[model samples]
Target: MDNIISKLRNLDAYPKINEDFYSRTLSGGVITLSSSILMLLLFISELRLYLHAVTETKLVVDTSRGETLRINFDVTFPALPCSLLSLDAMDISGEQHLDVKHDIIKKRLDSHGNAIEARPDGIGAPKIEKPLQRHGGRLEHNETYCGSCFGAESADDDCCNSCEEVREAYRKKGWALSNPDLIDQCKREGFLQRIKDEDGEGCNIYGFLEVNKVAGNFHFAPGKSFQQSNVHVHDLLAFQKDSFNISHKINRLAFGEYFPGVVNPLDSVQWKQETPSATYQYFIKVVPTVYNSVSGYTIQSNQFSVTEHVRTAEVGRLQSLPAVFFFYDLSPIKVTFTEEHVSFLHFLTNVCAIVGGVFTVSGILDSFIYHGQKVIKKKMEIGKFS
Candidate 1:
């Protein structure tokens, strides 16, 4: 045992260590040294590659108007890498000749390839530039031709005609047939007129003749150099004609309910304008259609009039609202319109890649720092043992 101890001491006293000891120390040092060196080398290579990418990157954009734009980015080391390089170019001069032939083919197939008939080629009938004149003659009223009664012809004088049948059917439900005066009022005012007697028993009676004159004569007046411009006058005229038809339908529906009686006779009526500055106002006219024998009369108004002033007020209020709020979807109402637009996929893809790369780089750096500290602590322990 003493000899063995002496041999062990002699081994320790030697200038050179044993092969196993040297090998283990060298292996551990190489592992730590190589890891640090490799990490630095990899980091430097990545930075250079990133810088190169940034310096060479470019983008080009072209538009239908023969305009072009080119953008260049400056190359940076840690701040900017080749991978971060970006450039934008825009060209605004190319003609966008939409290939609508495909759409036409699709539509044709949908229609079973039926040949579309072409509109007749000729000058259309002369437009009615002036309003129809109102004659002073009274509209003839025949008992057999009562407007309130359905299907009553002027030539038919029979009391048991279709009109009488309809009236008899209403009489069974306590609804008296409209009288001659009420029928005449409908012809003049374009609505059913109701009149009440002193006993509160009412009859559909006509009395007043209301005439509405054309408020304005709107005609298209071409500019002084109309012939020189590319604007098609015929197209404009067609548009105006269509617009007039639409406007007439809307106006008729809006104001038709108020005719004969402007206010409800059953209830105490009240009127309030939403805005005084409004060029157009919507006037609600409520009328009681169903009469309650016990409650005197139950008036239920559901009609409204949209005057020109109301439209002006709405447009003025819109200006005060924020553009973002106006464009945001806050209501359940959904509107869709067909229009050509650019795709947004490219913008989304770039944004995602940039965010992902930043996180990946940060994680790699943290790992390197943590591993380096652990290796240094191990080396210190090994030195103390030596």
Candidate 2:
């Protein structure tokens, strides 16, 4: 046992020296103190990096299928009245929503841009109490009131009970209601009078659009939309004007739920139509994104970049109506972000390296300085120093 103990002592790498024979100098003490502070600082820096999570980013081809995208928008048409403004959406899948009023709110604004009143958009006025039984017929008091759709009816027995139904019939027949006053339902419901009442007022329309996850377009235009001679036109409500001002501002527009570090470029965007009337278009490219947090939570969202264009109208030769159109397309690639901390073993290894490296360098520097000073002093004592 004694021999084994002696062998272990001989094998010890760190041999100790007696205090009486040890030499301590000011230079050595200074180097020791400096190196210790450096080691402490390096250790603190490494610890901080290990504790805080770092995010890793990667790009991959998006393979998602059969999903729907939700679009939230808040737009203000400062010169277009709510009575003349209409919303429409269409996609590549042959799906269309005309005169969208569901989940929508319209705020009437005055000239100074202050809201005068807010209300939900409706399908026009209430049903007329006394409707015409047929075109050029007498006002008869009957139990079942089958109003006339005029010549726009698809079937002879078809009936239009309200002004809205007549307009719908006209629309289906690819015709425009040039004069609503001639129709009794429209005359009694005051369609043109309603337009005249909301004249010169602005509208702030806020709504969300649910569309297919495909390339599509949604627009805000004046008057009810319909196709005539393969061209899109508005009924205009007989409120004809020399020009229309489609100047507008977008308060906020988001494609999906918000996530950390996501940016919406169209928020607070504004445009003014310098011409008599114009069409403002925005072409947006949306990229899908997935974020995985350190807490094991995941977020699916979208980010987009946009390009804008404006098509002005010629005074009397205008083809397109004054509108604001948003055309969006999806990207094939997707981005992913993951947050994680450094491993414990990696942190420990870095800490040990910093301490060992600083200590060794400081000891070598201290020994060289001490020996050089001693040699210079000895030479001076022997009168060999110059």
lDDT of 1 by residue, 1-386 (tens): 99999888788855775777532344455545655565566556555544331211122231123212111111111111111111111112221111111111111011122322322211122122221112223224431232233333223542221222333333333343334233322224321121111111111111111112111111111111111142211111211111110010010121122322333222222222233221212222211121112223332212222222123224535321000000001112211111222234643454455445544655565556656767999999999999
Off by over 4 Å in 2: 1-6, 9-52, 125-129, 135-142, 314-319, 350-386
Candidate 2 lDDT, 100-193, residue by residue in tens:
8898999999888999999988776545565667755545665567788879889988988778888888877878788888988888888789
Q: What's the C-alpha lDDT at position 17 in model 1? A: 58
Candidate 1: segments with Cα more than 4 A from true spot: 1-363, 375-386
Per-residue lDDT of 29 in model 2: 92
lDDT of 2 at 340: 94
